[model samples]
Target: MQDEKGILIVLSGPAGVGKGTVCNALREKNTGIEYSVSATTREPRAGEKDGVNYFFKTKLEFEKMIEDNRLLEWAKYVNNYYGTPIDPVLDTVNNGKDIILEIEVQGAKKVKERYPEGIFIFLMPPSLSELRTRITERGTETQDLINERMTVAQEELEMMEYYDYVVENDQVEYAVDRIRSIVTAEHCKRERLVEKYKQIVEVE
Candidate 1:
């Protein structure tokens, strides 16, 4: 697989759909998919480090990055900006390493427009009721905030129709297995490997 360009795996879904949990589990398997850390203008919480947790940037610096076309996709939330840096992602795949981006649906859509060849997987809740339950169980958000998230989640879930694959997050392990399988299958697609065979046969 290293001989070919690495695949870009985009995992996204509505908020509170366990996208992070599934991605973390997949990484723990040591399957060699590098997780792309996002840049943000938000202040870091306790024990969070720059670059490892996120690339912390001042609002001024972040806006500059956006102006310079440094970010693949960006969005402002709660008065702060968060986005994926274009360089690290491109560098990883160009150097023959797979990269996984666990992002919001809006960002994922933007990434797809840039890299249509990328594998886009949407994580779904078992049911809308279940999604509400998961959000409510977080217990950290205020009631109004939770309601806002649910409204946003509804809109994000509708975007699933644009994705290449959908995996239900009924359980973390199961969702992880499904995602890994998608990546493995994508690597074997003939369209992606035809060039190597042609080169071996010396076809023009």
Candidate 2:
């Protein structure tokens, strides 16, 4: 195994399930990880920086990227286009830093189809009722939108079994720690770490 070939991780979950928060915590714990930034046709919100929060682009520009086959996976959400740009993500993964893609279930499914070796993690809420409560507590969306999201959450949750690991976002710290452990354990896989151990054992 090459040291420069880093792990590619896909973290997927429903809205308001705390996947972003957990990814932030995980990055803090492990500095070698890089989070993948998505490209979007949506305009940046207040205090959002270009290229950091997201790669903001015009709809025409985004459409060109889709046409050029530059996006790994693109989807239309709420009349706007969002996608994972392929080049930057591949660069980070090749540089020996674990690359994490925080995306929806559909995008994640697309990634898995392309990179079958990638690690997929599904984040979940404790239950449907708890998820509804969390979404409502955010205070960002109206009641009708919340209901729609809750229904979508149910569909996303049904696809959890497709992931390699499942972490429940019932508690923030616990969920982050569990995800970190998964990443660490994956690094210790026999195919990657056994040869190093063998070399050490043969040392004088």
Candidate 3:
């Protein structure tokens, strides 16, 4: 137990792909998983907390962090700085609790570069048309903003080659089950458990 290292599970998808919903559902089903909270310079959305949802920072503060190379992966997203802090993710995984991150395409790429061994997952919507509908139904953005998101999403879908797995988020429950199964499978990998078996063999 003490020597077991945690797993890093990254979930990324286009806008309106139900990534947040699917991640939340998986967290509810599996209590051992930890969600990686990202830092952002944007104003907090409705019901979004500062530390829990995102570590809200001022532009200057965030830029200073960028200068210091404190972020694991950061980019100018929608005119704001959003990035993952390096400390929390490493600490959690070392503590033996699996960590999951829900990020966009560019951020996902950054995570892949920083943590190449991390488990990368891409969540896809049923279709691009349906993706448009879902974004429209939100009613929080103007048509122009929605269009921009859709454009970015289309580009993101084309970059799925970098991911270890792609889970279609057509149904929340189904997506949750698939992610859960992935964790179970990862645990069964021979390399992950070899250290424990080696110690036992030497003892007897």
How many pairs collide in each candidate, listed in order? 0, 0, 0
lDDT of 2 by residue, 146-195 (tens): 98888888888899989999999889899888877888888988876766
Tens digits of per-residue lDDT, candidate 1, 1-204, equal 227899999999887898877888988999999999999887786677898878999999999999999999988754678899999999999888899998888888889899999999999999888988887886756788788888888888888999999999999999989888999999999998997887877854
Model 3 misplaced regions, further than 4 Å? none
Model 2 accuracy (lDDT, Cα): 0.85
**Model 3: per-residue Cα lDDT over 1-204, one tens digit each:** 237788999899997898778878877886589998899998887888999889999999999989998888888866888888889999998887899988888988988988887889999999999999999998877899899999888889999999999999888998898998898898788888898888888889
Best by lDDT: 1
Model 1 residue 71 lDDT?
Answer: 95
> How well does each candidate superpose onto the true structure, as a TM-score?
0.92, 0.88, 0.95
Shift of residue 94 alpha carbon in model 2, Å: 1.3
Candidate 1 — worst ten consecutive residues by lDDT sum? 74-83
Candidate 2 off by > 4 Å:
1-4, 193-204
Which has the better TM-score: candidate 1, or candidate 3? Answer: 3
Candidate 1 wrong stretches, greater than 4 Å:
43-47
